[model samples]
Target: MTASFAAPRYIVDGGTEATSVLRRLARAGWTTREGFALPENTWDVSGTRLVLFGRVADADTAELAVLAAARGAGVVAIADAGSDVGRALYADLARVGPVSVDPDAPVAGESDEPASSGPQLAPEQRALLERLAGGETIAAAAAAEFLSLRTANRRIAEAREVLGVRTTREAVLAYLRIRRETREG
Candidate 1:
């Protein structure tokens, strides 16, 4: 008999959050990344067991919907702390499955924490970051990580939001700026 391994799961807050995570992972050299938004109806059928619901405005509602949709889906819910609702939501969702938060996550007015800080990384997020750090192409990163091109774009958007920048290029620059500052400090 052969055993099958399930993909890692995630539940990011929104499109922007998703993008930020993807970009960070790509730059960090992770591979085989896959994630999804926490859309109530559509995600259950997204095929992958691991799903990411990026930057949900209403954590309570999103949590309930995720719990409902994940009934038989076995999806892991990941939250971005940039949204105030995330803390409470993480606690509640943790009862059902693994729940994680990103303190450096960019919502609107998130803290000054590093994007790498906060809760443990979900399986998918960890893999994505590894490949990104390894210098994988955005498309290759997405494909190697099992994510769709659309989802890859969303992840890039998330990175931009975290850096308070509008585009991936800018976000990359911002990340570099921090690295340089740290090195010279």
Candidate 2:
């Protein structure tokens, strides 16, 4: 069997305490990327895990954080120290509110709680989505995946649930959006 591994999740932040934190993280073997300096108090984190930075800016930044998390890129916001504001920020990233993390906690995390917050498509779901995107009919897509029509519908239903959509078209669009985001990254 072939093995597949995900892309590295990145950690980025800025603050007075950030330099030490970044150093600690680097020493811990986490991948680090550059962004706002610590005193600037801005964090731009992305990868395939649970992390985020909130509104030092606006909705666009928040949306991007959410998208990154949804795409499975980690988004731990070390700059904010998981405060009231930080919990609030994580809540926004989670889209559910009141999500909390210990400020002093060592930075290993992944959120399996919220569906939309970190939805990952199963391989079959992805195949179906890709097939649909390619304009294949459901029966043809089912054949392509070697699944029965009923099983295919079930798979599509699961994808729709994970993507927080009510329709197959929206699921396809959401999957496509995820594909684009990961590719861009």
Candidate 3:
């Protein structure tokens, strides 16, 4: 058998508030040595696993984020609904493709591709989802795992971002589906 090589995929993100978002997400295991910077031009993202835009400052930046996501084929746009910049960035991303702004909605357009092609789940994230699948509440799961509520919710959010789903229920279902398929294949 011949060995095959595939280039490594990394996460590329930007925006005024991108650093903090990157910090939280980095803890979940998406490695990025190319740190967050203000998005000035549309970056080449076809090699990236994810393109994240957090609180873009202007319409141009928002457009750039969408462009990068389109090329990269995966994206996560984070913004506050109450803030103008957040609303603008979210709106721009939504216009081009489905963006997950609400907690219960499908985030970042997971429908664009198969979940199998997405990133592998972190151990903690997978553990949480497994517990939820077994019918435990997130709060209870968190307590059982000895994780704080904030940390648990953050993990759930990170799982959603990685699995390209929204809401803990959806994350649980996705986790189960992925596991089942992987085992069968």
lDDT of each residue in 1-185, candidate 1, tens digit only: 01132222335655565566555443433232233234465533324333333334475566654564344233334455455666555444533333334523332112345444323333333344446556776788789865777666565655555556786556555655655565676
Q: Which candidate's TM-score is highest?
A: 2
lDDT of each: 0.47, 0.54, 0.55
**Candidate 3: which stretches are off by over 4 Å?**
1-117
- Residues 9-52, model 3: lDDT tens digits: 12123343345444443544344433224254545444444434
Worst 10 residues of 3 by lDDT: 1-10
How many Å off is the CA of 77 in candidate 1? 8.1
TM-score of 1: 0.33
TM-score of each: 0.33, 0.39, 0.38
Ranked candidates, highest lDDT first: 3, 2, 1
Question: How would the candidate models be sorted by TM-score, starting from the highest?
Answer: 2, 3, 1
Which model, 1 or 3, shows the larger TM-score? 3
Q: Compute the lDDT of residue 127 as modeled in candidate 2.
A: 83
* lDDT pick, better of 2 and 3: 3
